[model samples]
Target chain A: MDEKKLAIIATKGTLDWAYPPFILASTASALGYETEIFFTFYGLQLLKKDLDLKVSPLGNPGMPMPMGMDKWFPTLLTALPGMESVMTSMMKKKMASKGVASLEELRELCQEAEVRLIACQMTVDLFDMDPAAFIEGVEFAGAARFFEFAGQSDICLYI
Target chain B: MADFDEELDASGLNCPLPILRAKKTLAGMESGKVLHIIATDPGSVKDFEAFARQTGNELMESKEEGGKFQFLIKKA
Candidate 1:
């Protein structure tokens, strides 16, 4: 059988949203699939150096509290000032306790597994972000290159 | 211990780590070498089977003992 190819488009910047693409890319690579992730728009934030990713629970009613807190409390708390940072910290702690790898760890694993990381050139220009601001091993490309990968991929995801 | 070429204990790791480490380990070993892995994650059962199928490795043995999942994979 031919090796499967996977191409993922990552367009979200938040901490919670960042995990899905990286997790999928790394897992797919582990499965011996040719995997690449195109980071565009808000997803460009993930590749930025020293970027502090945060979770915004405000207006997000689906945020689950591991302690099984009622939705009302989180809804009310998220409305308070600085609550997003608080929620982000809480979520990180919860993830750590669960033995889940951190984003940095996952990024390293992706690199080790040879998963290609592509940063959108247009997004960098639009956001006024320097290409040097991104982590190492990132290739800069436009949507045309992304499409080329997507066209041939067995699994294509826009997340 | 000598029965397997490499022993990977992914006991506490979740989701892709078990499979990721196993894949990395397998990459370093010669073909026909067996890798023994112990994992506590319930998802590992399906994950390993799928990994074996996708990578064309042979899953020689898979069993559950005392809540831990054990697997023996022969690298192809």
Candidate 2:
């Protein structure tokens, strides 16, 4: 039987938004599926050589406040200075305690599993992002290139 | 108890880590060799079943002990 294929379009770059694409791609590859992740717009940030991903609590009603402060924590306070850093740190600590893999670790696993990491060239040109800023082994391509592979995939997801 | 050629302890790790580690271990084993895995993630029960099905490996045994989940898979 032919190997199954999975194609993913990653469009989000936030800390909370990063896990789905990498996790799914890596897992699918392990399941014996050929997998590719097309990084576009903000999602291209994930391919950076140095990752400094951060999460924000503002307008995120679902985010539970840290240190047992959930019930009375004011949404307006999320807009205050340095709130993003505070929330990001809290989330990192919480994930560490839960034994969740970091984005780097997941991405590395994907690479090891031979999952293709494609960076959208248009986004790179539009954002003026330096090509050298991205990690090695990334393929830069256009939407047409992605569609060529995605069209033949048994599963295609936009995340 | 099913005999296993290799053992993987994936306690505390969540979601795909356990499955990913098991796949890596199984890849290094000879065909028909059994891989014993112990994972703490509840999601792994279903994940391992699906993994065995999708990868064509045989899940020789699966059960819970105390608070942990144990699985024995024969490499395909």
Candidate 3:
């Protein structure tokens, strides 16, 4: 059977939110499928060296620590820690312990697996991002081109 | 092969990884070849179940071990 093409549209900017697309795409590639990830809006941040680790705690009441810390100081306490790495590291470790690969490894595998990573040029300018800040091997495209890319996908996921 | 025909040791992988691997592997097989996949990721349990339903893959068996998950899938 011919391998199907898969596309994952990433719009979330947080580290936790960022994992699914790379994970799915890399996994798809491992399965011998053609995979692509179109990063737009906040999703573009994942490719940026500086913004790869920041994540919002929305929908996670148990987040921001101490088990009930969000209630007391609010999730703002998460900002107080000032280290997205601490939370992100813990989260990645948890995911890894569950047999999930780390985000860094996943990204590498996605690249190695030939999962094409495309960044939306419009969103880059909208957010005022430096194209150089993103990881290597990313191509810039407009929505029309992305639509054409996505139209060929057998499975398309938005995460 | 027995009714429980094949086994895939895919422990220590998470979420879409297990299912994606399963799908990729399944796409190449003759129909009705059963595959059993063992995984340590809880998310894979749900992921595989949903994948089976969406893609018309048949899940012949599923189980767990101290946080690990096992599946018997028949390619459809």
Which candidate has the highest lDDT of all?
A: 2
List, residue by residue over A1-159, the lDDT tens digit for candidate 3: 577889888998787787888877876675557888889898887787655565545446656553555677555455555446666667766666777666777687688677889999999888788888888999999878778868988998888
Query: In candidate 2, what are the lDDT values of residues A1-159, reduced to their tens digit?
Result: 589999999999999999999999999999999999999999999999999999988887777876756667887887999989988998999999999999999999999999999999999999999999999999999999999999999999999
CA shift of A149, model 1, Å: 1.2
What DockQ do you compute for every candidate structure?
0.87, 0.93, 0.36
Model 3, B1-76: lDDT tens digits are 2365556677777666677667656766789988878787777777777777666778777887677788888987
Off by over 4 Å in 1: A74-76
True contacts kept of 2: 0.88
Ranking by lDDT: 2, 1, 3
The candidate, 2 or 3, that scores higher on lDDT is 2
Rank by TM-score, descending? 2, 1, 3
Local accuracy of candidate 2 as per-residue lDDT tens digits, B1-76: 7678899999999989999999999999999899999999999999999999999999989999999999999998
RMSD after Cα superposition, model 3: 4.6
Q: What are the lDDT scores of the predictions, listed in order?
A: 0.89, 0.94, 0.75
Model 3 chain A: ten consecutive residues of lowest lDDT: A74-83
The candidate scoring highest on TM-score is 2
What CA RMSD would you report for each candidate? 1.7, 1.0, 4.6
True contacts kept of each: 0.85, 0.88, 0.62
Judged by whole-model lDDT over C-alpha atoms, candidate 2 comes out at 0.94
